[model samples]
Target chain A: MKCPLCGLEFNQEDGLKGCSGCKSMGACGLIKCPNCGYEVPAESGIVKFIKRWRKKTDESK
Target chain B: MTVNLSRKRPQCHSTADMEIDARRSVVLVGSPNVGKSVVFGNLTGMYVTVSNYPGTTVEITRGRLADDSRAVAITDTPGMYSLLSITEEERVARRVLMENRPDMVVHVADTKNIERMLHLTVQLLEAGMPLVLDLNLMDEAERLGMRVDTKVLKERLGIPVVATVATKGMGMDELKKMILKEDILPSGPPLRYPETIENAIADIAKNLDSSYGISKRAVALLLLQDDHEIWQMVRDREPERYALVDAIVKHARERFADPLNYIITIERQRFINTLIEDAMDNDQVKGIPFRERLSRLSMHPVAGVPIFLGIIYLLYEFVGVFGAQTAVDFLEETVFGQYINPVANRIVSSIIPWKVLQDLFVNEYGIITLGIRYAIAIILPIVTTFFIAFSIIEDTGYLPRLAMLIDRVFKKIGLNGRAVIPVVLGFGCDTMATMVTRTLETRRERVIATLLLALAIPCSAQMGVILALLSGSTKALGIFVMVMGTVFLFVGFLAARLMPGERPLFYMEVPPLRWPKLSNVLTKTYTRVEWYFKEVLPLFILASILIWAGRITGLFDLVIKVLSYPTGWIGLPPEASKAFLYGFFRRDFGAAGLYDLKTSGALSGVPLVVSIITIALFMPCIAQFSMTIKERGWKMAVGMAAFIFPFAFVVGYLVNLILNGLGVVL
Candidate 1:
């Protein structure tokens, strides 16, 4: 995912694996950008799979 | 895309062997938001995880690269501006450099920001790391008619420099080749400082026996700049020379009118400018593009207000009407009410003979009936819609412009444009926004932003519900907006006055506004929704259970009776007390309670407006309260809550009193 604030591209996983000191690490579910501390939502696995599948089909067309 | 060096033992950040790897291990380091991760992904495919850099909770990504005989470990560090660290992230990045003596240090920089970004590159060179500078994001830079001479830059710095469009895999082959060639990986001479500073550094470096994995000159420079970590390291490792080191640093500081750190930064900037002068060329046309003009208009004080208001209205229509009314009604009344709830109620009742256990699962506030319903049916659609809209705004690069537009207002509250990030974010979720307040430079700014967020900014869920409640009555909605706006400004001004700190200077790079790509928007929205569900679902269930327990013990009824006094004081009926109590758990749920009242013809006109205003201004939900405590500590969080609870009602009462006095009916 691209951080909108700083325009840095990072893996969604790196974003979700936020600072460990945060009390709501497991539950808050926000992905903190490693560069700037901007928080974005964590994308689900199913959505990612579907999007990839759709893109593949679209390219085939 | 893989480059392999000689086989040797891996050097992790935790290890202190001070053994430089004979085999090639690559470490990527740069300022944050410079596309280091993209470069890392291209270099090492699919072998990455969050590895803590020893004692700190900060995570740096460590990945493995493979070839025919040996595997090299590649570590991607957190963003750091210089060797002198200001943030924990910077400290971790510096530690990774000191502890892991990687064969090649890939300093990734955004090509668009070559001037500002070159300082870190100079710092890395001074540290005596074997450096390969990758100027990433050349595509964006070229689009702006800016050209960088990679050959000139290489000659000027005496290091291997590669220009790359990392996103499109441009210049990857050259970068890979540079990383693999051992002969090309030469240690450049450190940046020479002014003569006086050079003499002081030389005096200090003469006494230092160890560089501790970095150059002795770098250590000497850090000591002169009063780097605490270096001071501590010196105290622990070379106590005999610590006093001498301290005196040299003190003498250096006394010699300068400005702090030595600032002096050093200025010197570095001067050096960087000389380098940039030879390396970069600009041929930008006199006339700006239409997109650039639009970007300017979006930040113009007069023009930007209407655009901002338009965006807000669009947000209401999308998140409120389409999401809250259309999607929520279908999910709530049709899906859950007509199908799921009845089925779940029947199943729980048939299985459990005891009324208590059945009630816990199937009753009005049951885990499944209320909690799951609220999470999916009410909150999900609203948050999803808001996230999608927000992601589009972010991806289009309008946020920085918005920050510029509102910076004047923010200044009145002792905050600069940077505070706009958290304020805009508070609409998504105040809990997360509270956490983001950590990004602010000053304690005073963070505190004021925190107080304003808690007092006036409504989270998406709460905003969605309130918008749904009052959208039918335009007059009521207007009043609600006016009251919240007034309170936001007034409280922010007071807090700014009460707090103490210098107003920070505001400077931010505003990226060119572009059309938002569908893939990016969808991906971001999906990520946010997934995160939102992971956070809100369990909390909603716990809230249901707590409410059920409170009901079973009759505490719920007692609290409702007591709250009715304040409800009446705000000119709302006794029936409104239940909604107010539900609000303590979740703001949206409480607003949803009022929605039920309005539909059933219980709340309307002046009282309805008062109820919505008070609930919007009420203390944030439990998650936000805990986050406030985490970020601002217990005293500030508790104090904020204590002040806000009464203040919400007082404002509500005053609004009600004024409206009734005018004989106004909406």
Candidate 2:
């Protein structure tokens, strides 16, 4: 995801790696941009599900 | 050939006597998302192995080049902006470059952002690394009507330059051929500083006796910039000459008004500008793009205020009126009030023999009736809409522009524009925003930003509840906004005056405004709402159980009775003390309590507005307080709370006195 603040694009995994020391302990579900430390919420399971479903449908088509 | 890709501890200064392999090693390096990993894959194919750089969590990828005849190992280092590292990842990348002494260093850059990317390119050249400049993302550069004359660039920088859209396999063969060539050599430093710095660099380089993997000129430059790691290394390795080098750096620093880092960067940028002038063509359409014009207007001093107010009004309509009023009313009155509460009360009353046990699940303060209802019915709708609106705003890339718009005002408050990032984010979550204050350059700025956040900035859930509480009367809402805004600026100004600190410098990149992608907004909203529910629901239920326990133990009444004096002094009813008590648990809980009071005709008119202002300025939630303690330490956190709680009531008292004294009708 691209950091809206600094325009640095990074992998979600990389963003999570930066969050290892945060007090929220991943319960906050925020992904901190590795470059700028700007936090944005990670995608929820429902959204991921919808995305996967859409991708499967597209493939079928 | 078998390769061990297991994590290896970085040998900072010792590369001698390490096992040497016949395979020529190449390291791919760049800023984030410039296709370094993709280029790595292109060079190495499917035989890649990943491992953490030892002592750090940052990953390193290594593989052999796909060509069977030539034995070549390719390593992809973490993305880094500069050799003068700020982040751990950047430090690791620099370590990889300095320690490995790779036969080839490929600096993959985003072609569209060559201006920004060239800073790193210049640093690589200064290091005298065997460098190849790969201008990746050429398709994007072309789309932006940018053309880089690779031949001219190569000739100017005295290095190989390859342009490729790595994802499309464009220029892969050329890149491969360039990497395979054995003749690549150090391109030498690409810039010369002013005479003072040049003299200092020459002095420092002359004293260095031991070999640093990179050029001694680069070491001298890093030393002049007071690079701590190099300072330690030089002190360790060249102990006798370290003092002279340190004196040279100090003398050089005394000659410049700015820090050597800033001075050096300016000189490098000046060189890059002239270099770019000769080698690149920007054929972007002659006129300013509409988006660019809109972006400018959004940050314009005169025009930005209305745009800011316009955004606030839209938020009020969406989250306040629609979510807090309409959606909340349906969920609270129709779903919980009409259906869930009655059924739960009846079922609990029938099943549970003891009235105490029954009260735990039903009645006014029951876990099921109050906690669940408040969480699912009132707070949920409000925060959901808030998250949706916020996600849209963020996706539009308006926050950075907002930061720029507010920078001038923020400077007066001992904060640079960067503080705006945390302040705006505080609306979403103050706890997170407090954590983010680490990004500020000075400790003083962080403290001021933290105090302001704790005192005046209400999180999204709390703001939504207050907006709903005030939405009935525009005059009342107007006064509420006016009073809170006054307190925010007033306190911030006072904090700035009281705190002794250097004036903060402001700089931020304002990304171009774009129509928000619907999918992104939706996904962001869903994620935030999900997080909100996951975090808040259990806490609300726990609060309810604790409230029940406290009431039974008579602790709740004692606290509420003590709280009532302040509540009454603020012109609020005695019952409102319960909300004040709840406020410390979570700011939104208190606001939700007030929503209940208003609905029951217990709180109204001037008192309602005063209570909202007070609660908004009240001590931050328990989580935020703990975060404050963690970020600012115990003494500072305690001092802030000591000032905030009473100050909140005093301000509330004064607002109440003025409004009633003026005979202002709500």
Q: Chain A vs. true chain A, TM-score per candidate?
A: 0.67, 0.84
Candidate 1 chain B least-lDDT 10 residues: B2-11
* Local accuracy of candidate 2 as per-residue lDDT tens digits, B90-153: 8789999988898999999998778788889998899989999999999977765577899989
- Candidates' C-alpha lDDT: 0.78, 0.83
Output the number of the lDDT-best candidate: 2
Report per-prediction Cα RMSD to one decimal.
7.5, 5.8
TM-score of 1: 0.72
Label model 2 with its docking quality class: acceptable
TM-score of each: 0.72, 0.79
Real A-B contacts recovered, model 1 = 0.52
